[model samples]
Target chain A: EPEVTQTPSHQVTQMGQEVILHCVPISNHLYFYWYRQILGQKVEFLVSFYNNEISEKSEIFDDQFSVERPDGSNFTLKIRSTKLEDSAMYFCASSEGTGRGGRPGELFFGEGSRLTVL
Target chain B: AQKVTQAQTEISVVEKEDVTLDCVYETRDTTYYLFWYKQPPSGELVFLIRRNSFDEQNEISGRYSWNFQKSTSSFNFTITASQVVDSAVYFCALSDFNRDDKIIFGKGTRLHILP
Candidate 1:
C-alpha cells in the first residue's frame, strides 16, 4: 500500500538554529498535515495544507513555523529558530479529500521524524 | 473545541486475556469522526479503525471489536484473546467535519500483553 514518507528519521539541532522537516505525501492525496508529539504527551496538530496553502493552524504553529509545498511531491515544515520545547516526534499525514472515496475521512500517517534540540 | 480522552494510562494483560481500551470525546459538531490508532515501540502509527458519528452500530473484525455509543459520546475498543503482538500505545482521536479536518489525539493508553 502507498504510504506517506518523511525524510531525516531523526535530527539533532542546536537551539536557535534553523531546522527543516520534509515529507512526501501519497501521490494522489489532496490534503496534507503536520502534527507533533512531545515526549510522553498526546499528539498535537500543527497545521494543515491544501491547494498549496495553509488551511488551518494551531497556537503552537506560531511565526517561527512555516510549511511549504515547493514541488508537486514535496511538503516541508521549517522552524526558523528552534527551541528546547521544539524537540518532539513530528508526523506527516495525508488524505483524499472528504467524500472523494467511500472512506474519505481516513488519514494515513508516516513513521514520524524525531527532532532533538539541544 | 474537540477533545479525546483515554483515561487508562497503562494496562498489562496475560496472553489470551481479553482487554478493552476506553475512549471518551467532547465535541459540539453534529458531524464528526472517531478513530483508533496503534503505535508500537518502533514509534510508527498504525491506523486501526474509524467510526463516524451517524453510525452508532457496533462493529466486529476478527478478534477486534468497537463499540460506538453516541448517547454517551464514547467509542471503546476491545481485543479478545489478545497476544503479545497486541502490545502497543493505543490512541483515540477525534475530527470535526465542519472544521479543517484537523485530528486531535488523546493521551494514549499503553498496553503490554505479557506472554
Candidate 2:
C-alpha cells in the first residue's frame, strides 16, 4: 500500500537553530497535515495544508512555525527557531480525500520524525 | 473543541485471550467521525476502523470489533483471541466533516500481550 514518507527519521538540532521536516505524501492525496507528540502525550495537530495553502492551524503553530508545499510532491514544515519544548515526534499524514473519514484515502500517517532539540 | 479520552492507560492480557479498550470522546458538532489506530514499537500508525456519528451500526472485521454508542459517547474496540502481535498502543481520534483535516487523538492505551 502507498503511504506517506518523511525524511530524516531522527534529527538532533541545537536550540535557536532552524530545521525543516520534509514529507512526500501519497501521489493522489489532496489533503496533508502535520502533527506532533511529546513522549507519552496525545498527538496534537499543528497545521493542515491543501490547495497550496494553509487550511487551519493550532495555537502551537506560532510565527516560528511554517508549512509549505514547495513543489508537487514535497510538503515541508520549517521551524524558524527551535526550542527545548519543540522536541517531539513529528508526523505527516495525507488523505486521498476526506469524506468524514469513510472515503478511500482516509488519513495515512508516516512513521514520524523524532526531533531532539538541545 | 474536541477531546478523546482513553481512560485505560494500559492493559495486560495473555496469549489467545480477549481484550477491550475503551474510548470516550467529547465533541460539540453533530456530524463527526471516530477512528481507531494502532502504533507498534516501530512508532508507525496503522489505521483500524472508522465510524461516523450518524451511523451507529456496530461493525466486526475478522477478529476486531467496534462498538460505537453515541448515547454514551463511547467507541470501544475489542480484539478476540488476540495473539502476541496484537500488543501495541491503541489510539482513538475524532474529526468532523465540516473541517478538512483537523483530527484530535487521545493519549492512547498501551496493550501488552504476554506468553
Candidate 3:
C-alpha cells in the first residue's frame, strides 16, 4: 500500500537554530497535515494544507512555523527558530480529498521525524 | 471544539488475555469520523480503524473489535487473545466533517502484553 514518508528520522538542534522537516505524501492525496506529539502526550494538530495553501492552523502554530508544498510531491515544515519546548515527534499525514459517500477521508500518517532541541 | 479522551493511560495484560481500551469523544457536529491508530516502540503511527458517524455496527476483524456508541459518544477497542506484538500505544482520534478534517487525538493508552 502507498504510504507517507518523512525524512530525518531523528534531528538534534540548538534552541535558537532553524529546523526543517520533509515529507512526501501519497501521490493521489490532496490534503496534507502536520502534527506534533510531545513525549507521552497527545498528538496536536499544527497545520493543514490543501490546494497548495494553508487551509487551517492551530494556536500552537504561531509565527515561528511555516509549511510549504515546495514541489509536486514534497511538503516541508520550517521552524524559524526552534525552542526547547519544540522538541517533539512531528508527523506528516495525507488523505485523498474525500471518501465514498461524502465522508471525510481517512488520514495515513508517516513514521514521524523526532526533533530534539538542546 | 472536538475532543477525544482515552481514559486509560496505560494497561498491562498477560499474553493471550483479552483487553479493552476505553475512548470517549465530544463533538458538536452530527457528522464526524472516529479512528484508532497504533504507535509502536519505533514511534510510527499505524492506521488501525476508522468509523463514520452513520456506522454504528460493531465490527470485528480477526482478534480486533470496535464498539461505537453514538448515544454515549464513545468508541472503544478490544483486543482478544492479545500477544506480545500487540504491545503499543493506541490513540483514539476524532475529526469533524464541518471542520477542515484536521484530526484531534487523545493522549493514548499504552498497552503492554507481557509474555
| The best candidate in terms of DockQ | 2
Colliding residue pairs in candidate 1? none
Candidate 1 runs further than 4 Å off: A99-102
The estimated TM-scores of all candidates read 0.96, 0.97, 0.95
What ordering of candidates by DockQ runs from best to worst?
A: 2, 1, 3
Q: Which ten residues in a row have the lowest lDDT in candidate 3 chain A?
A: A97-106
RMSD of 3: 1.6
- B32-83 in candidate 2: lDDT tens per residue? 9899999998997888888888899999999999999999999999999999
Q: Candidates' lDDT values, in order?
A: 0.91, 0.91, 0.91
Tens-place lDDT digits, model 1, residues B39-104 = 998887888888888999999999999999999999999999999999999999998865535888
**Candidate 3 structure quality by residue, lDDT tens digits, B2-107:** 8889999999999999999999999889898889999999888887888989999999999999999999999999999999999999999998765635789999
Cand. 1 Cα-lDDT: 0.91
Name the runs in model 3 displaced over 4 angstroms. Answer: A99-105
Fnat computed for model 1: 0.54
Every candidate's DockQ is 0.64, 0.66, 0.63
Lowest lDDT sum, 10 consecutive residues, model 1 chain A, at A98-107
For the predicted complex of model 3, DockQ is: 0.63
Write down the RMSD of candidate 1 (Cα, Å): 1.3
lDDT of 1 by residue, A25-51 (tens): 999989999999899889999999988
Model 1 chain B lowest lDDT segment of ten: B95-104
